[model samples]
Target: MANSAPASVWRNPIHFLAFGLGSGAVPKAPGTFGTLAAVPFFLLLQNLSDVQYAIMLVVTSLVGIYLCGKTSKDLGVHDHSGIVWDEFVGYWITMWMAPAGWFYIVLGFVLFRLFDILKPWPISWIDKNVHGGFGIMLDDILAGLMSFVVLQALVRFVF
Candidate 1:
């Protein structure tokens, strides 16, 4: 079963981050809301060069492993519903090198959320087989990559 938001999410800095800065604390569809919260951060990152953006992705992803694992362990839950850092990172990944416009942003959002929610093929496999914080983040990472491909393609051809 899915785990609910814990008090530690507000009290502990790590939990606060893992929960996507409290965006995950929402009672329903926290991942969606958490991804919504990520939009502003993505806007901030849009100005970065590709290399710098890649570095930021790496840093955030690495930190997410620790934040998610520690928070899940503390809460005694595996991939708690409120842990939405993965969603934030995933959304960011989807928007990598995307065109600067509301259309691209919204498209990236939809694509990322679709892949994340659907969890096709390897994503579903990894989600089932992996464990701990890395596991929690891996599935979303794949989803982001998949969405990135689609979004980039749209930029190249459709848009």
Candidate 2:
């Protein structure tokens, strides 16, 4: 199926990034596609020192607020399914300093997606009650943080 976004929307760099390099435009499972698009970024940052990695996540999250907010307004949709920059940053957050190799990456991906889609507790509350760019980013941020906690625990205790 064709992308639901307007033609002019792609002209804006913010919208493009917010769409996860067009992966978000996918007709099905855009969030999954966006999360997949994030894998490369996670790999690139894999070797950085913890401080540097943290800085990168902070920068991306800050920028994602504007990106997602603007794109949502432009599309006249709140938290549109195609707006997946949140997924990109969320996946990165979930994978931060995760174990090396494909297994860990896949595990991180699954965990992140699970929390993101499920939107438990604070995530659900934020998704329902918050507004604007920060709101769009907040739920996914919590989901990422939650996934990180679970992944870390599993790595430490189960695996």
Candidate 3:
């Protein structure tokens, strides 16, 4: 930025992701846009077998923690809204309960965004204070958990 605090924070990856690979940097709700951008990745991850899905989810979360942490450190920001890799992995976590379907995907997306945005109780708690790798990944992980539980309930009762 022209008068942003640190010079280092304005680097390439931070700049790119800060715009959400240019999406967040748009003139609208960048965070929402960033989350929206994670959809296709979710679809790709959704195609795998249950065992593969589980393995991928674990790996994605683990990798996301490190990646988010490193990126935050580099950007001189903590859990910057621009970083949406956590969003990607988190959405994948939400889809873990069932196979890919537009209804489930859309609902899961909405729920995850709600938990992420409204930050109900614990999500709000984490967003307000935590600052680091786990901090960055924790809220989204929780959102995914919330999505998973709700989706599972819906599947068990309705379907």
Candidate 4:
């Protein structure tokens, strides 16, 4: 079940970001909403050069650790379902070096969501055992990377 959004999500700036600019507050499928919210930002980032995009991925992922951790701490929750800055970073990772088109964007979204939701192998293991903000971010990071590999392959071979 989805954890309800804390009141601070609106009042606190950090919490607001952790909650994916309020996208995570939805009653159902907050993660999906959060990922969806990331699409626009991804579109904007597409303008950047590959190196710039990679830098953004690293910076956002690093900031997400603190944002998610601090918000979770403030709310006394461990990786609250409402905290979704990680989703933004994860989606960004999945789109790295992707072709410039809506088709690839949609495909990256689907692939990233699949890897994130399925939690295969080590991702599941890490999600189970890890704790705190880094733990929360790590699993999605893996999901994005796994998605990245597959998306790249599809671009290379099939699409």
Candidate 5:
């Protein structure tokens, strides 16, 4: 798939993020790689105050809409599996306000992946119905929100 991707796919800056800094080009489980690629960024963001983190999240998500949309149009594929920026954003959302520690990171990762893959209820609904850049982002956004709720609960009540 990477080999077949258009040259512009690599040349375009937006594609870099949409492709998860080339992690999305990985042949297997690109979404997982994308999520993993997000870890360092998450660590960086973790140091910020909650307000700063929230602002960055909003910026990333807003840019992601255009980045993913343009890349999908360039690739002639809507929400291509190779486009994993959504995963990066989604995982970050899942980790929002999560407790500090590698344990929480792993927990967030696992839970986010489950919700993303399973696409339960509204997530599934949005995936099937939405279109364009917004469509590309909405499902993962929902998954992240759902995962955030669960992770916060576990952090507060169980751990």
Candidate 6:
């Protein structure tokens, strides 16, 4: 992290949105913080129809590529750990197709955060090996997918 702030960051719009208005600029636990930021959004999306939720997730993921990319670039780093809008969208994607209920929502949040933090196998590998905006976004996407599968399977088995 820079001891001094980058002056030009304020002028960059991608940095503005992606950093959560500079929330990502925090020095520690950026991913966790980013995921925390995602929770309210998850609640909102849960109320929408499945198709509406899916469309929103897709659009966010695509825009996240640019948003995350440009913000990382501005920070003079490749996928800096602080930038977490990607994680937000990833969690949304995980929950979008799932049945809507408070219980499932909490479970999904826990599951998504676990996979996100653990980053098992290929997820951890890619996070280490890949670079750029997509790289930052991909691991969380995979983690979200895994969480979604678990949520789906549970719905199938228990419900």
Off by over 4 Å in 6: 1-11
Clashes of each: 0, 0, 3, 0, 0, 0
Query: Best candidate per lDDT, number?
Result: 1
lDDT of 5 at 69: 93
> lDDT score of model 6?
0.77
lDDT of 2 by residue, 1-159 (tens): 234765654687878888988889877898999999999988889999988989999999999999989988877888988889999889888988788999999999999999998999989999999977899999999999999998999999999
The better-scoring model by TM-score among 2 and 5 is 2
- Ranked by TM-score, the better of candidates 3 and 4 is 4
What lDDT is reached at residue 105 by model 5? 97
Residue-level lDDT tens digits of model 4 in 1-159? 347988898999999999999999987888899999999999999989999999999999999999999998988888889888988899999999999999999999999999988999899999889988999999999999999999999999997
Question: Which 10-residue window of candidate 2 scores lowest in summed lDDT?
Answer: 1-10
Question: For model 1, what is the alpha-carbon lDDT of residue 140?
Answer: 97
lDDT of 6 by residue, 26-118 (tens): 677766667777878787777888788878878888888889888778778777666777778777867867886778877888888899989
Better of 1 and 3 by lDDT: 1
lDDT of 1 at 47: 100
Q: How far in Å is the alpha carbon of 128 misplaced in model 1?
A: 0.6
Better of 3 and 5 by lDDT: 5
lDDT of each: 0.94, 0.88, 0.71, 0.93, 0.88, 0.77
User: Which is the winner by lDDT between candidate 4 and candidate 5?
Assistant: 4
TM-score of 4: 0.97
RMSD of each: 0.8, 1.9, 3.6, 0.9, 1.8, 2.6
Candidate 4, residue 77: Cα displacement in angstroms equals 1.1
Best by TM-score: 1
TM-score of each: 0.98, 0.95, 0.81, 0.97, 0.94, 0.84
lDDT of 1 by residue, 28-108 (tens): 999999999999999999999999999999999999999999998998889999999999999999999998999988999
Q: Pairing residues by index, what is the TM-score of model 6?
A: 0.84
TM-score for candidate 3: 0.81
